[model samples]
Target: MSENLNPAELQKTCLYDRHVALQAKMSPFAGFMMPIQYDSITVEHNAVRQKVGMFDVSHMGEVFVEGPEAEKFVNWIFTNEIRGFEPGKVLYGMMCYPDGGVVDDLLVYREFAPDHFLLVVNAANIDKDFAWIEEHAKGFDCTVRNESPVWGQIAVQGPESEKVLADVLGLPEAANLGFYTFYDTEYKGKRMIVSRTGYTGEDGFELYTSIDGTVELWDRLIAAGVQPCGLGCRDTLRFEAGLPLYGDELSAEISPVMAGLGMFCKFDKDFIGKEALLAQKGGEIARKLVGIEIEDKAIPRAGYPVELEDGTEVGIVTTGYHSISLDKSICFALVDKAYAALDTPLSIRIRKKVFPGKVVKKRFYQTNYKK
Candidate 1:
């Protein structure tokens, strides 16, 4: 954290200088000084939709788990099956407490060795998650280290990501890594980890390199025809893809199942939230996550009330944005189970006036993945 920044401590990412040099609009996000847009939000958002764009996601947290008991520790703590994920593969999962409340949503990337792995978590929840994981691994023969400060991450996403990466990034048979898998490589003599995973619903690669090499990598990619995208587009892109944001769609009070991530849960595995999730499964689900399309021009915002025809509030909007792809206002909500049906008519209370809306399938935008 830097001393010059205020309240939230405007942390700097590896590409902070590049953003300033590009004359980007800077803002505080998740306690970091991030570029909200380089040119314009909608223009950058549309650029990524059509071509490859890079993001400075170095503020994300990276934790290392090693030793013989690493696998056991992770399997017991996360609500996903680790055994099924082959080495060099990646899986999406959540860390939950005993009561089934989510700690954070994370991507678990298996290393070349079974006893080693990297956990990429949200920036804001790094300390909380690291403390929790460390305390849980007390007796286990595992070492948990917070390596976020030493590393930097960049997400190169969009339809043309493959072409851009193939030209700029040098790795070992790098292009051959399957989707959701990663490969060890070297860029400019520095050891790097390139994963075929990205938050955007686009076919892209996430490059993890040493903090020292961050600026060079960003420059190289930009020179290789990858546009620098900002946090604004990142949010709109992920939201349009129906990917849940940590604070909005998931949190300490929100269960993964309630966030429309029931498929990621392994019922057979006895995880921290297994008991509660199982109990909730046996009975009817009280609330369900759904996507809503606003018909009016008013953009629905988070914390807005979701009401029915009779003006009865049924849910609350969790995330909302103007979709560059859909050309409409879109939002996600945790509505009562009965209101989760597709095409269900609903209204979003915006500035005291109800805007017409309807529940729709979440994949509001499609992803282009390399087969």
Candidate 2:
């Protein structure tokens, strides 16, 4: 917390003051002054794994789509099938360019109203994503609104999340809802949403409400001794859970098909990137994402070259770590498709030495999502 950080003009979330008051390790992330850790990354990570932890994800962006053509418009831009999705249900997918590059990966919440939907996007891509959305919406008979400035969101995650949310917050309805579903209700005379979607691969709930309500909830949760997590632990938890970060795993150069997320992209219907993705699937794609487990304790970092047994460079590591939960060096890498098969011998170049490893399942840790 004492290191001199770069003085870049950054945006602040609704809980910025709370993090500062706690003396959290604040860093610039996604153009916002976000908390990297409160006490320790490992402590906060473990709290979310064994008990319950909370993250002030108020910096995430929110967009509202409403009109007679809302459903049609969303389905056109999104990769997933939202044609007949029921209200209160949420779908995770990507918005793509005509050439199949990802604009952003987001969660779309179907509202109870027949002609309305809400999109929760990444914090860093807020401006870019909204502009893309607005551009594509020119011909549609719908209205798009970037409501990120007014909304606040918090993710309460772990095995004990339900109990904490129900007992501490008195939101019993949260317990009644199932995974990937949400319910809208009034809190302190203001509208709010409670959704079950865990980015950490744990049973969790993300509460979206007014900024004041978010602050009050944070205060109460802290008073009740729930560990306040930050982006550092959030990254580790999500990585262990086998979730993909947008810029790292899926980017302008990486498509959902290339990242092994083709399951989320529906091909039966037409979308903005349908033809390009279809062509990519039908053609011989050069690179694909795979998991590599190194035998040594050497931690692999991003941009480190992945090599063949003969010292030929095949690809590079996208994300890697000495996994806290698994206690091994592992990473996600984009490699030549010819070498992506299970049990293929591979090596990662760490600084000056090449460490041998093998292709393994990307999901290094088993998740506990309560039914």
> Best-fitting candidate, measured by TM-score?
2
Error in Å for residue 154 of model 1: 0.9
* lDDT for 353 (candidate 2): 97
lDDT of 1 by residue, 1-371 (tens): 12235945577888888899989999887778889999788877887788888999999999999999999899888888998678998999999887777999999988997699999999888889999999999999999999998899998888877777777765436578778999887766787898999878888889998987777889888787678889889999999888998888988777888887877889887778888877766654688889999887788889999999899999999989878888898899999988899999999999879998899988899877666
Overall local distance difference test of candidate 1: 0.86
Output the worst ten-in-a-row residue range by lDDT, candidate 2.
Answer: 1-10
lDDT of each: 0.86, 0.92
Candidate 1, residue 338: the lDDT equals 86
- Candidate 2 lDDT score relative to the true structure: 0.92
Candidate 2 residue-wise lDDT, 71-185, digit = tens: 8899999999998799999999999998888999999999998899999999889999999999988899999999998899999999999999889999877988888999998
Give each prediction's root-mean-square deviation over alpha carbons: 2.3, 2.3
The most accurate candidate by lDDT is 2
TM-score of each: 0.95, 0.97
Can you tell me which runs of candidate 1 are displaced by over 4 Å?
Answer: 1-8
